[model samples]
Target: MHLFIRATDAGAPPYLYAGPMTYRGHEGERPMRILWDLAHPLPADVFHYAKVNTG
Candidate 1:
């Protein structure tokens, strides 16, 4: 399935296209974390921003 991602909603940032992804697996019950394998890699800037902001 296709994936879209944005860093925040403060200014209603437009979602960046993360390309298609494949279901990888998941864990946990309460939160139900899910994993996906991206079909294509994200750009350097987008990857860095997402990583830093998300963590």
Candidate 2:
């Protein structure tokens, strides 16, 4: 897994994480259980980012 992560990470080094982790909470008094979402970090949208003049 480490190798795979490294390869993917190299492919796109700007993103913090490439996946999302989710889990369901226990029953609550409101008759609805809460779902938890955990993620490492948000990635930058290069499509909408300003272009730099490297020239």
Candidate 3:
């Protein structure tokens, strides 16, 4: 399956879906459970993003 993610680190690449995950509370609140698929990075450069001069 294909996926996308807003990666913070440029070196770290995205990956495929693994399993479910849960977020624990800090002090005394109920834990939050979130189920989602992981993102996978593409091998090729799909879009050529560059700064353009519109002067």
Each candidate structure's count of clashing pairs: 0, 0, 0
Best by lDDT: 1
Residue 34 lDDT in candidate 2: 60
User: Model 3: C-alpha RMSD to truth?
Assistant: 12.8
Name the 10 consecutive residues with the lowest summed lDDT in model 3. Answer: 46-55
Q: Residue 32 error for model 1, in Å?
A: 0.8
lDDT tens readout by residue for model 1, 1-55 = 9989876757766788889999999999999999999999999988988888879
Q: List model 2 lDDT by residue over 1-55, tens digit each.
A: 1111222334566433345556747676878766645455333443123222112
Model 3, range 1-55, lDDT digits (tens) per residue? 3333333346755533333433433443366443433343333332121112112
By lDDT, highest first, what's the ranking? 1, 2, 3
The reply for model 2, stretches above 4 Å from the true place, is 1-19, 41-55
Please give each candidate's TM-score: 0.81, 0.23, 0.18
Instruction: Assess each prediction's global lDDT (C-alpha) against the native.
Output: 0.88, 0.41, 0.35
Native-to-model Cα distance after best TM-score fit, residue 21 in candidate 3, in Å? 13
Best by TM-score: 1
Clashing pairs in 2: none
Ranking by TM-score: 1, 2, 3
**Worst 10-residue stretch by lDDT in candidate 1?**
6-15
